[model samples]
Target: MSEQATTTPTDDEQRGASTLELFFDLVFVFTITQFTHAFGHEPTWKSAGTIALLFAVIWWMYSGYVWLTNEVAPSTPARRTVLVVGMFGFFTLALAVPDAVHGHGVVFGWAFLGVTLVHAVLFRVSGGDDASAAILRILPTNLAAAICMVIGGYAHGSATYLWWVGALLVIGVSPLLSTARGFVLRTKHFCERHALVLIIAIGESIIGVGTGLAEETMNLQFFVQVLLGLTVIYVMWWSFFGNDNEHGEAALDDLPMTDRTRTALIAYGYCFVPMLLGIVFAAAGLGMAIGQGERQASWAAATALSGGVALYLAGQALFRAALGLPRPWMRLLAAILAVLTTALGVYVAEWVQLAAIAVVVYGAIIVDDVIGLRAGERSSYLAG
Candidate 1:
């Protein structure tokens, strides 16, 4: 333990997310809020699909930068400038989302293309040779996507929307085509960044409840439902962080260097999509449930409420499975039950449906805790 013998970890080991990276995340908060606002106005299948596609695009943009920053320092003035520009580009996209499905499709498309281009540029500049080669490999597909977003922006009707779908398809599959080597991950930085994003997504659900309550007259039922919505949010938080999050972080910390980048990409990168999407859905659902009082939920509201929880559970299951953790199957079963609960909601009040989903999530935690006890392992459920 002598000072000379206790060598300093390399820059790579010491690196963490910078202030600019965090500021960039705040932009996405607004983006998520905009998506929630757009969906709340018209909670239908059409709107849902539009929101989902938008969410997918935004998630990719945000996560792609996260990977880049994990590889290189964003503290340099130039890199910091790029982040600011990207933030504006994302902001443009969020602003256009309200009209993305129709008249402003072109605006949305252009803004998204700008963000993706920024990603490519940042990757080229900071991601090293292997990263550059990976960018080169995916360039053609990304270019095609850019074109689709621009053209689709102006194109009308189903033709236009198809282009959006085409863009997402190309970008979505590019990860599979990547073959560039020598990629590395800063494990602690990567896990912390993702966990922070999940926290922000959870905030969206709380915001949903707040917005919903704003529209209703204050009363006992209103307060009760508000508490219910808040409880559901707590359950969602408990379900993730209170379970394997710390263990998963530890797993990443010890992951072999050879497998680090790919494992982080698969585990944290992709799994977050559904998990964050679930928050958005739950927000919309919780808001509707609160606003409607004793009124029954519309198809969109009920689906959003119940399906959101199901998706979160499923995402968690996938996340743990990707990390080579045990009991992912049990989580999967919980997700299936969540899906079934949505159907059952057809016969119950919306608040009741929301409560049912919360109970189910809570039950999943309890079951896991009991299993841990029987197996002589301490569960995280009761931990601070």
Candidate 2:
């Protein structure tokens, strides 16, 4: 093992997230709240699209910093300074979220740029020490991205906005892209913990639905909406905390130290793509069920819930493939689609849409549980 790797906390040393990391995560709660509120106003396909893209932007920005703290261990003095400055920059970005694409985009740009520069300087300063080689690997691309981000902010009025911003983000993440194979110090444990954090974040979708329902009405319809929201949460718990997590960790355990960390990073890092998509769709689905488009509620909301489930399962598939696990995510995907189909039938028959979605979700859980039981039985039989 490298001296650096040995000196760093082992998986046993850091049991999940640190207290400070959790505090940093609270910042994102603001970001998510802003996202839901902003999207809530539009509540259309376009809004959904915007929210999805925004998730990529936000998650990439956030995870990169987390990765740095891991490789560099910035909780110390000089590193602490970088983190504090970055925090100020992040705060600005959070404050600008209410109008990122429109009114207050400049604030967003300035904040992101500040963070970018802060990150770059930290890399430059730490060069050749404390994984500085890894740091340099990302610095140039990130700097280019930061410059373009600011320029894109200035050009939001034209056709150039899409191309500029898209290109910028591409450059920003190119190093972290699959090619260089990511940082050496990258740990799967770090990534998995973050992945769980995201699942917990997605659980917030249920809250969004509940908050929406609590606004101004009460009836069988209202109660059904609440029940459906809860059901979606149940499904997330069932699907994610199922065998995939255990198998994923076991797969990591099977690898060499560096290999384990790298695999974990790739598997966990990429999960943000599908997870954020799923979570956002879930939120949108909830939005559909409460007060807007009463006629379309059944189909639209069901679609959102189903889409979210699909994304989550798909992410798991990719993650499992990376981890060399069997195709466990497939069953989850099948269950999701099955429920969605049943939901459609319920809608056409004019039953309460939310109630229908709830039943479908519970059915999926039951199916997975049965599969688990059968698998256990087979194992026991083999043992005997």
Using lDDT, give the best candidate's number: 1
Total backbone collisions, model 2: 0
Residue 155 lDDT (model 1): 85
- Candidate 2: pairs in clash: none
Q: Tens-digit lDDT track for model 1 on 190-209?
A: 88788887887788668756
Residues 41-127, model 2: lDDT tens digits: 665676666666656666666777666655555545676667778877777777887677677766777787788777766655652
lDDT of each: 0.77, 0.60
Model 2: per-residue Cα lDDT at residue 217 = 69
- How many clashes (backbone N, Cα, C below 3 Å) per candidate? 1, 0
The TM-score values for the models, in the order shown, are 0.91, 0.80
Q: Scored by Cα lDDT, where does model 2 land?
A: 0.60
Q: Model 1: how far is 343 from its true place, Å?
A: 4.5
